[model samples]
Target: MSDNTTHPERCRCCGTMAVHRRLLDQDPGYARRRSRIEEHAFRAMRGTIVQRPGCTRIPVVVHVVYNTDEQNISREQIDSQIEILNEDFRKANADISTVPAPFAPVAADARLLFALAASDPDGNPTDGITRTRTDVSGFVDDDKVKADASGGKDAWPADEYLNIWVCPLSGGLLGYAQFPGGPAATDGVVVTYTGFGNMGTARAPFDLGRTTTHEIGHWLNLFHIWGDDGTGCSGSDFVDDTPNQGGANLGKPTFPKVSCDNGPDGDMFMNYMDYVDDDTMVMFTEGQVARMQACLDGPRSAIGEMVSCTPLHPKALPKDTPKEFTKEPIKDPPKERPKDNPKEFVKEPVKESVKEGPKDLIKDGIKDGGKELPKDNPKDFGKDPGLEPGKWKPLDPPPKQIFEVPTKQLVEGPVGGKQAFENPLPGGWGNQPVQPMQPMQPAQPLQPFVLATGQAPSGASLKPPVADGGGEQDQSQALLGEYAQLLAQYAQLYQQGMLDQQGMLAWQQAWAAYVQLGGR
Candidate 1:
């Protein structure tokens, strides 16, 4: 085996971009699909579309193509890779706390959950793994490792499962992935055995299983943070939030390193899309999440629609299957008792002998001169002697008392001969008539609702009203119309399975702010 100690440079670490270019050149259909996918991503990003509610579960199939015993990794290693994917994609990795304060706000949980497929293409129970003994010493980025004829195992259906091929990679290459628009036969990702997982035969600096995470990011339609411009300032990863970078950052780079005039908070080298080591890269941004969600909504929607994480037997039907076909026939209940047969239902009463105790307690009390109580009578309670039956007499009114108004008394004061109270309070409160209460001026008609710079307080755009009318009612109507349009768009995306919980919440907050501003 070649020396595993030497790490490849940032540009050569992943071969996804190279594979992408080759596919664009060789297949015309792939190029067209790539264009359409990009257009969809662009729309999603521009609209800031919310993701669908709940976690998206994806079934995975790992194909292990090995040439030696060491290359044939253990089940624990494969499981470790799956767990790492779950953590990294969901932003549940422990290292995520190390993200800088500035970038942490945009760091997002993709809400993508991955599990080993429970059933194979033929609906047979499976462990979600395939091991093939390959004679080829090492596989290149050319994709021979994806087929059985080329000394590798063929992929499962790409539309139903995410195919992962783990083998020894040639030319110091770590891994590569075929993007969403590629042919299904060669779809999915490939990782080197040493860089595939965190345990057994896994090597340092690459053992945390982030290689598969990064490649799957590619599979989910994410571009590198550096924008793949080959050390130029002109490239764009198509994500708006990520800082523009001239080239990929390799190894462990300190925070806030400037490039392409992106200063202060410079290139996001710690991003999973960059070439940093496993322990270094830790996050995916909200913009990247939107892009991936667009892919799930469009090109790759089928794989996530249904997921089975445990083996499924052929005889067992889905939960939604008709009950009549899946369950046993109903049995008749026992007969009810006949109402006419009252004699048979009745039981014989038992005779009881009464015992006397504390005899004549009431009579003894009466003999001791206890007063007898009156008999119960409705007329005896709540009766007023002064009031006639069915008639109420009004009480006489009390005599009114007269109050003497105070007259101003003369006192020695600085103002000559001015009538003043003998004792004057501070602030000119002496001997003055009480001021009549002033009516509150009708609350100053609320100032016209205006959004400064057309932005909500949360920094989301309010998307100005369509009409230019100066009337408040017209402006409010326009704003309401715009809000309604946004709601309609949100509902459509949600129905199409394009929105995730985070995206849905963000859009909800935005429209809620609009409503507060009198949109509706």
Candidate 2:
């Protein structure tokens, strides 16, 4: 009908007609079927038919094609686009308040919401995101970006999933979309990576993820507000309520923009379907919402009817559960099981002794340099308390992987050229002259408990205790082992709600009384 030329300045969605032309060229009966659906939708839009009640949730799948690290956008960016869609479609955007007072009453919510598909076409679980690495530098509006053979991914079933392609678009084209009734493999929208979302590569003037909003509006069978005619007064988007505008508005225009002899409130440039900047566009007129409703009821009804089987995230467990009680993969980025490896499919049986061991106790203290000491007898730690290691294991304890409390430092420092003690009485001297304290270095990783034997100029030099000789060392080592057991027992008792502050102190006094009487 019109010139059918490309416009790279504002958008490149004019290629939808080109796709229609190709479909017409290849299929003999396709045009008839497409026209029938379109005619029915148009008739419904004009009140010859009624639209379906209630909102529809469209399942969306985002296909990310990248040639470089910068092009592979983050999940946050993808989520940002989805949020914008839901906000704009449901008339819930924060900026909905910005619509000019005259147009506020005319602005309508389309009653549509979008969600990343929970399951794929074949009923496989998915995050609704597919990432593909490509060698092709960039793409134009040629639709090559829709095919895996052409360095892009093939679309999922169009009747089931709304496939969105995010990649580097050349020629300053913000985005484009195929209207309903196009070929399934090439259906959906393509957005330039830079204009795809609100963050990352998303730049100024197009950074609000509104490019995706505009493109999805096209996907839902909406035409440009100015109707694609080049600056002429005689253009029709085929909707009644939208004021007839001479041409597309580019930037933010003030209220009461006059055009096409429509006075007072002329161009509805704030509409998403218009060519205005992302921040400038705000509302979709009620008539536009009706037209979109007709398309959903007629051509795209299959998509809305497909039931989503996405599972909800499970609620978190109670905070009292010990972390070691929960199972976890031993390796990061869990390695795939080997085909011939015996351990691949077979799970090691949990030893009964380890399973029934005292609640929060580690069976053995960690060895020096992170190695686990080999058991002299497999059942010694579990069966016999008499044979327990008399000395604290010389190694640094295992990295505090279990849920011990986070360590807090008392960090005494100088404030305003004077040292401020949190507890002035504990330092035992009032008005004592001390050197100005320097800023503390960052806390180091947790280390095993060491005895303070010598004082250095800056701080204490604590060394791991060594066993020298007979009864004294034995008694000291035995006391340390007893203390370790007390800690483990106390942790378990506390977790069971049997011990609070006073209860814990009473247990400690009883243990000390037993130790002093040599009752081990």
Candidate 3:
């Protein structure tokens, strides 16, 4: 049987009947546990149990599941909700003045304050709002939305925190709550995102964040003021102060709304536990406060004990611990031998090899005043050629120009037989005055051919070739082909179980060769 209670448009909270159905269907022993809770509440109302000392601050975590942009409420909106909860729970709501005169004296401060947890369950600092993007448009009272697998976040430790889920609710449910003694995973309340916070996506009639206030009342073990019976006075909220009413009220009710033959005083329709618009609900009566206080002293005592400060991550290893290596060392060393015969290398004439040296290319490109990029065709600079030209949007106003200073600030020396720049520019670079243009140095002879990888030293540029008939395209294709062939050879060696450090070194050399051949 469907036990969900549907309310009119003004307020729709399916609290007691929904929870009763869920527990009965899911647990065999729910009835006995619920009866015990009722007995405890009854005793508290009759003054057998004392209210808790001072105010108990309950730490809260709000999970926001959004399908649209607006549903992801802002920080201010969350803060507003918390503010409203604090006001309503403590009986400090500004509208408490609107409560009927007869019911005003019995309105009690529940002495509860709600705070967003300062840290998450993992002990990391948090603002207490978790946002998740979901494809599900709305959630019924089925509780599927309480799981990460079901497009919502799993609740934090229910014993330590009040987990509130803010999302769009299906079946016109403004909100619902799991009364104490339910499964820990699904503990806490589900409030519609549109009715959650006063700001951002909050709709009319429900915009003041009273839905959370009303649902949280159930979480604290308070029953509906009108009782859950269908328009019958036999149903009781188990509180003496609240007048017997026919059923849940809608919109706003005038004073002296007599029901069930209660004449001089009428139904307390302004109570938070009743189904009314956000603006209509006003306060929780003293009898209701006693019932909720009994719950805190019984089922929910642990929530008051938890410290919401940031906790350290569970998997964080101690700094003093040493790491163990996973793989065994290679048995074979690299097979690439050092270049053969350094003495015989000087026998080759220097002039014949000058074009291969990178220094000459730089000198040739900059011999004129400054290099010019081809009219509108800026170099693609190692980017994918398959990129659609239509998608390339030019910068409206280009970034500020950076001055390229020549290599005069450097000292030249032979480093591992390759020309290396020495004495780099010092810090506080902008303080130094720009130097006059220096005369170009004579081109140096090339080093013995060895494949080089990685970037040129800072302040050096790879000069693109002068405009020739598709020479750059042909060179790029040839380099790419060679790179592919070298990769194929490496794969074959691996398959034959012949690949070792030597093969790895060969692959590195192939990459260097591609760079040298202007593959970019």
TM-score rank order: 1, 3, 2
- For 1-520, candidate 1 gives per-residue lDDT tens digits of 1112354533337888889878766886775567557645654554534446666899999999999999999999999999888878777787888999989999988878898999999999999999999899999999999999989899999999999999999878899999898999999999999998899988978889999999999999887787676677766676778998877777788988899998888988889998887889999998898888888987898886533323322222454577665454333222233443554545322112122323456557666544433443435564656367323222321222011112221123213444222122235433433333222223422111111011112211122322344565665456555545555444434433456766465455434434444543
Candidate 1, clashing residue pairs?
51-499, 51-500, 52-499, 52-500
lDDT of 1 at 241: 83
The residue pairs in collision within model 2 are none
Give the poorly placed runs of model 3, Cα more than 4 Å off.
Answer: 1-8, 305-520
Candidate lDDT scores, in order, read: 0.70, 0.66, 0.66
Error of 2 at 13 (Å): 7.1
What are the per-residue Cα lDDT tens digits for candidate 3 across 395-447? 22122211121222111212232111111112523233333222222242121
In lDDT terms, how accurate is model 2?
0.66
Residue pairs with backbone overlap in model 3: 123-311
Off by over 4 Å in 2: 1-30, 305-520
lDDT of 2 by residue, 1-520 (tens): 2232364444423344455556666765555555455555544553435577678889999999999999999999999899888778878777888888878987988888789999987899999999999999888777899999999999999988889999987757677888777677888999989998799999878888888888888788777777665687755665667888987777678877999898888888899988777898888887889878888887788886533324221123334456655555565324555544556335443454356554434534333323534444546666775565433321223324122422221112122322122222235232333332222223521211100111111111111123355464565455445444443443334434455655554444433333332333
Q: Give all TM-scores, in the order shown.
A: 0.60, 0.56, 0.57
